[model samples]
Target: MTNKHSETSFFITAEEAADQLGVSRATLYAYVSRGLLRAHPTDSDSRRNCYARDDVVDLAGKRRRGRKPVDIAKSTLDWGMPVLESAITLIRDGQLYYRTNNAVALSERASLEDVACLLWDLPQADELEITPSVLPDGWHLLKAHYAKVPIIEALLPLFAIASEDGQTGIWQCDEARLASGAATLLGALFACITGCCPDRHPLHVQLATAWGQGPVGADLVRQALVLCADHELNASSFTARCVASTEASLRMAIIGGLAALSGGRHGGMTERIETAWQAIDPDNMTAHIRRQLAAGVEFPGFGHPLYPQGDARAKALLGSILPDFRFADEIVETMRALTGKAPSIDFALVAMRRYLGLPEGAAFCVFALGRSVGWIAHALEQRRQGQLIRPRAVYVGPDPGSSA
Candidate 1:
């Protein structure tokens, strides 16, 4: 509660309102500048400003909740529990569970041709309804590393940049620049989110059961890559807007945005990258799981809905070079059996890491790196919004504790 400047009939001085609102003068001004409230210049000198009393009161009644940071690299289930066996059975009976003949006879053929054939098996695009993803002719990484474009351009048929020039007009980043930038950011995010790509992906937790914890490091790296990029609208975006509202420098706003993304909930899932592997330690599945639970942590990376059959990402990546991936036919079958739902990217990557003998921490690193792309895009968009990140809300509150 700071001091007040003065009170007027329809409004209050910036200083007085600041005091009455129980916030710093700077805080009050921030809301005003963000267009959350109306401001009026007081006198000829322009030394003072006044704001509508009602607006001030209304704003005070609305407080925004802090955003949780997003860890895109962290794995989430597509649906409910897919695998529910202990590590012991995963290792022992895994041979029976993982073996699959469905794609077996076909996978042995030439990879490129075989994969092309597999493409035909792909479920109908309209079924997904969200959007049909496509691989832009160039780059090849097993884990669904098709071409990624910025939302602004991706949404447009011509891949044109969104601008304010007019219906048929506008000026923004050109196609070349946007495409190049979008691809680079997305690639980085993928690497960060999952420890590897299709050719380079690791076996995720659900898939990692057959393999030990030794070689999954590369998969963790991919996790970092995936966590690095995503939609531009996230918690960090809000923070970036807060800074940009002040007309602050781009660098400063981005810094603020990054800070917001670092919080848990948003970025928390990234930890699952590492958690998934810990469950697959070769020493003992039951013991490891028990220890993990006692420590208040659960296994990471399993289950998904989009690919109720299995993580298309995993199936595709493994299908690309299953024989070369070095996992036993039985173990693969075991994973398939356990996963009642889709085998998400995380589960596939974790399994690969276990098969390859990579070190620990690779998963988390991958996740962090992957989401960095989305963060950068958001930071850039925040500045472009040309408005502060302020949302209005209903002001329903009970009378002060006992003061009512």
Candidate 2:
């Protein structure tokens, strides 16, 4: 997202520029046909237009005098196009891209109109309010829910007793504990499951005792737990702050956060991941790797940008509870052999889901549930802080002194 290389002047489209001017697309096209608008197209498609800052300002200045705009033949202008497209992008990289959410690279010009159409799409979030909370809040501090537990609470758990199972061993993904002991948050979660499961495997009973689950059910619960965990700074967070800033109820913020988590991205990744997993076959992992790579697709299970050494979360989950799952090893080894990388949380989660007999479509639910514990904790924290977060962006537009 760095724009250090971008010059002040750049390329933009008639459609995008038109929107900025509060003009209709048809009107902009008319201007383009006239000599008044300078259109820079990278290829045959005029939709791939780029505008020079100087040229746009110049045109804007010309329009200010109330002179009728002129039209020039499409053939009249022909100097540089790809160069123009390379400039004038909101989000710039080595080269300018349209920043469309479509799977295809925005490198090649996508439709300007379609890109603009998404302007209205908004995410929903849950609302939460807390009179006060002892935990930290927000997307960044999701893991803080566990690793950052209070000392008094930790001691209370050890001395406290549960109704049926004796102890509700709440394992934590604390970095220190992970390094010398259970190894990861994911591992900790799995151990908790095994600790709690009624039909825990003899070998896994120890793990269940530490974690806890049931053979007949808990898939939905687990998935909900993960999904509810953390959804990137979303609707709920927004609504919560909106309420808090106005000094509203804590309960409202929790509801806001809930609504946001249900949005297309957060609740949906599990489904997306499931679709990806189904498209890939763990049985023919080698073939699957080659096929996906040949097709120029990223293999589903490996490599996370955040975790360079492999996702510690994934490693902790796979390494601890399902320690003997060979498919996990196969995936890591084959991916390394094919692409020179390790597996990530998604991959590890998929493998876990696959082994647990959770349908591909349902894998994300597990993630959702895992995330919920953290989400509730964070919401509580945000409610506790009693501060509304509102980030601002730099205004890079026409100045009052400028002619246009």
Q: Which segments of candidate 1 are over 4 A away from where they belong? A: 1-228, 232-268, 281-298, 304-339, 346-359, 393-398, 401-404
Cα TM-score per model: 0.35, 0.39
* Cα distance off (Å), candidate 2, residue 285: 2.7
lDDT of 1: 0.38
lDDT of 2 at 223: 28
Off by over 4 Å in 2: 1-267, 281-284, 320-324, 359-362, 396-404
Over the stretch 1-404, how does candidate 1's per-residue lDDT look in tens digits? 11143343666778878877776665564445334566676654364678777877776665322122121112111121111111100111111111122222222222211221122122221121111123333323322332253211111121111111122111113422332333333333333233233222222331233223332433333332332223223455446556656665433443454455444344334345445554455545546555765787645444542334454445543554356654323335444444334444555544544445544433333333333433334444444556565544333577566573
Worst 10 residues of 1 by lDDT: 88-97
Model 2, 32-140: lDDT tens digits are 5333566565555544666555677776665554332222212212221111111111221111122223212320232211222222111211211111111212312
Predictions in order: lDDT: 0.38, 0.39
Question: C-alpha displacement of 165 in model 2, angstroms?
Answer: 31
